[model samples]
Target: MLRTIRRAAFDQARTQLLSPLSLLAALAMPCVFAFVLHSFAPGRTTPDMAVGIAGIGMLNAVIVDLLGAMSKEKVWRTLYPALGSPGGLVPVVLGRLAGIAAQALVSLPGTLLVLVLAWGISPDFDWFRWLAGGLLLAIATTAVVGLLAYFLLRFPSSPGMTNGLTGILIALSALLVPNAALPAVVQPIAWLIPQSHVMAWTRGGDIPQILIALGQVVVFSAVVLASLRRLERIAREQSVPLEY
Candidate 1:
């Protein structure tokens, strides 16, 4: 299982890192957003903004890129072999998503550099808090992306679906704005997003919030694994073509 996962991760990471467009989207776009945001409000760029920008980059990397890859695999009819592998779809998908999640980490330094250079803002960088929160956020986001892939792969004709879902998640992530600033109705929904709690923990170093975020990751991961098993079973039982 570990070998299978490592191979899948390596393959996915190699493919993504080799793509100029993926690099631009995952690394360059965050810096651009940071520059634009700082330009708009000069001195008002907060550490939270840095986190938000990096979070957006991470989301784009994991959600957009992962879904796009899955869609391409579906079109090329290449995922069929992986589905029939001994480890099946869950470990392969999880490992591939892990590779994308790891790639998303580049956004952190990119965002930090832009904040320091463009806005003259030095955030009180807490490595422990950031790493803990980031790890949990990555896990939760990967699970969510995996879940989305299950649906999106079934309907590969909708090319914009990934972007649309990514946009909605970013809005609800509390990365751009404070949770308190969101409307009352939206506030509750924002808390449900893993990034909201992860951001809260990152900014304030709140233990309970991180714990809640961990719990959310656990739940979401379980759902993703279950969904993958069911998807595989359905494909086998109904003779559904996964590469359609």
Candidate 2:
């Protein structure tokens, strides 16, 4: 299992890196957003803000790029063999997403560099905290994206749905705004979002909040594994292909 996962991760990372256009866009979008925010909301821009933006960029890679790759695999009929592989598709999916998540880490420094050079913003960046918290957030995001792949890959209109979902998640992520600033009713729903808790931790929240975020990651990971099992079972029993 470990070998399979490692091989898949290597392959996925290589493939993504080789795609220069996609790779450029993935790294550039966060910097663009950071510049725009710094230009307009100068007062709100801080080191924590840069970290939060970077975190959201990592998620954009996981959710958008990962799903886009899955869709391509389905179209090219490349996913069928993985589904039948000895280790099954779960590890392959997780590994590929892990690769993508790791690649997304580049956006961290990319965003910070833009802030420093473009805006003369010298943020007191905490490297240890950002790397550690960003990694945890990426893992949780990978699990959530893997689960989303199960449903989104089956539809013809997945691209539109993917964009819509990404926008919604970002709006509620609380990376740009405080949770307390959100409406009382929406606060509960935002708390349930893994990114919200993870962002809180990244921004120097207390220990309990980080624990809750890690707990959510574990739960989401378990749910993803179980869903993959069900997906495989249904595919075998009903002759249902991964895509419609």
Candidate 3:
């Protein structure tokens, strides 16, 4: 299982990160989005928050890659064969989840570097806080990615359906602006999104809030696993096979 996870992560990095064309396609839009986010922020004191908001765009890029990978598996008729493997589908799906997280982790440094150099944004926190925040962000991103992957895979015909939800999530995250600043109608929705608290932790939120963010990740992960199992059962009942 460990080997599978490693191989999956490696393959994801190679295909998406190492491939010149894929890198260009994947990074282009995110870079543009990041620039726009920086323009909105335009604040020197809260550089960390601004950078975090920009970095969120990169997370979206990773999500798109994972969605594309899943779409290819189904379109190319490889999902069934993958599920039928000796290790079963759980490890494969878990590996994909891990791979997606790993890909995001790997890209974070470069993302930060770009924000620092290009946007002149520097996190005002200490090294220890930065490290802890990075760890939390990775876990948070994994949970969010898993949930979105479940939706995309479950409703393969409407892959773009998750985009609207993701946009709402980003807006509700309060990365670019404080939740208090949000419009009255949207303010309540911000409380429901984990980022309301999660981002706070990275920006010096209390211990309790950080723990809540961690708890959210755990709950989201379990939901993702349960959804995967349900999908597997449906595939079995349908007797889906990879017909070449």
Full-model lDDT, candidate 2 = 0.71
Clashing pairs in 2: none
lDDT (CA) per prediction? 0.73, 0.71, 0.62
RMSD of each: 2.3, 2.4, 3.3
List, residue by residue over 1-244, the lDDT tens digit for candidate 1: 7887787688788778657777677667677767766666667445566677888788788876787667667766756786787877777777777788887777777666766776665455556665565566666667666677678655545646655776778778876667887889999998986788888877775688878887887888788878888888887788777876
Tens digit per residue, CA lDDT, model 3, 12-42: 6666666444354335544666677667666
Which stretches in model 2 have alpha-carbon errors above 4 Å?
Answer: 43-45, 121-124, 156-158
Q: Candidate 2: count the clashes.
A: 0
Candidate scoring better on lDDT of 2 and 3: 2
Q: What is the lDDT for 98 in model 3?
A: 74
Score residue 203 of candidate 2 by CA lDDT: 79
Which stretches of candidate 3 lie above 4 Å from their native place?
A: 19-34, 37-47, 119-125, 157-162, 240-244
Score candidate 3 by TM-score against the native: 0.80
Candidate closest to the true structure, highest TM-score: 1
Cα lDDT tens digits, model 2, 1-244, are: 7887787688777777556655564566667677666676774345567777776677677766676667666776756787788777777777777777777777677766666666565456676667777667667667666778667544554336766665667657776677887889888988886878877877788778878888887887888888877877887788776854
List the candidate 1 regions with Cα displacement exceeding 4 Å: 39-41, 44-46, 123-127
